[model samples]
Target: MKKTIPFSLLALLLYLAAACSTPKQRVPEQTASYTPASQELYDTIARMDSVMFDAFNKQDPDKLKEVFSEDLEFYHDKGGVTDYAQTMENFRTLFERNRDTGLRRDLVKGSLEVYPIVGFGAVEICLHRFCHQENGQDDCGTFKNIMLWQQKDGKWKVTRVISYDH
Candidate 1:
């Protein structure tokens, strides 16, 4: 009887030891890599550029205002650092001066650069302007835009924009 009890106790200890020693299913460490093929991420960045450019071409101050964050800051070529309200006001003034002012975005290029948790993009934009009131003169200028974007809650949002003429 004593021998049997000892054997049982040893078996129980062995079982517990084995159970605790069993290696857990090793989970692969999450690596931080920018996979460009991710359709959702690509679309998010593309949409941000599209909306921004569309607002510019249409001269829709309201839409443009909505695209930018409340605390957005813009550094323009001619204009220095502009706050959100100031930028909107500038656009409004421009639109008001020339009701027929039309903008054509040409040769716009964009690229995405990713970091561990954040990313940014550099965009080259060619601005073409046509206004009948201004003698129908066509104006052309090239600008380099550096925009910082962040992924928040699976959505990409532009936080800052800095542009300078080349």
Candidate 2:
């Protein structure tokens, strides 16, 4: 004698079969073309990088503050997190303490990933921090940086910066 399957079991099998047969959704790949406005924004961000690097090398707190948003957040390699005001204060204190100290950054590699309203940049940087030590040595290392930028008032301003040694 043949046995009959329950109605609920048959429905479950049909649902499983339909789900298995459906194709998975795919994410679109990034393309190279950029809109005119996006290109303008990219150029502005690139220029901002130069300004920021110059401020860092010069240890100018006012210049650094101009590049950063009012609600900026900074994550440092030495396990320290700072907000905009705190970061600016720290830079001021450092500049006052070591008047002769200097720092420079070299951009090794960088890329910008743009979204609808925001963009993120990944940069590999080499840092050289010099001070008048006993042996006159310089602290040097390579670090990977991730920066988040947002378009505000027709310009791109850095909202967050995170860096770690490479």
Candidate 3:
């Protein structure tokens, strides 16, 4: 006895066969929107920034030990790249050298932008001015900075830093 396939099954098989024969095009990656972060996240990052920079302003590299990750990557425009150890050492030397002169960093008003990184912590983009005593006058320079903060075990630390536009 001869058996015949059902019309619906045949049509579906043909459609699938045609679909399989066609070349597939890859979809472009979709980037997240640049929306403002939640107020809670913004506040948390702001506080963290304060903590980290406060240590810098105080010339206390020890305080930064908890703020930066052990495998931190810091990229500076003029100074190039520095790992965690070198970065910390540089900070120590800078702090020691400028201890008496005093260097202060102030965040430019309305220039702070915080964005979440999904599973990671957040990205902080801001303009800060560093001021120091030069020739008995305040010498300040404003620069752009991008910091990648990572959150783990209920603690936040900066994992990468991109400081440029000096």
lDDT of each prediction vs. the true structure?
0.59, 0.64, 0.87
1-166: candidate 3 lDDT, tens digit per residue: 9999999999999999988895432222224444465989988999999999898899889999999999899999999999999999999998877887779887776677899999999999988878888778777778889999999999999999999877
Put down candidate 2 lDDT per residue, 54-125, tens digits, no spaces.
887787888888878889898988858899999889878877876665555654433343333534442212
Candidate 1 residue 131 Cα shift, in angstroms, is 9.0
Q: What does candidate 1 score on TM?
A: 0.58
TM per prediction: 0.58, 0.59, 0.78
Tens digits of lDDT, candidate 1, 40-149: 55566567767876786777888877667677788877778898788789888877776665554532333343222335432322222222334666554544556666
Model 3 Cα shift for residue 160 (angstroms): 0.6
Which has the greatest TM-score?
3
lDDT of 2: 0.64
The alpha-carbon lDDT assigned to residue 92 of candidate 2 equals 89
lDDT of 3 at 52: 90
- Of the candidates numbered 2 and 3, which has the greater TM-score value? 3
Model 2: worst 10 consecutive residues (lDDT sum):
122-131
Off by over 4 Å in 3: 1-35
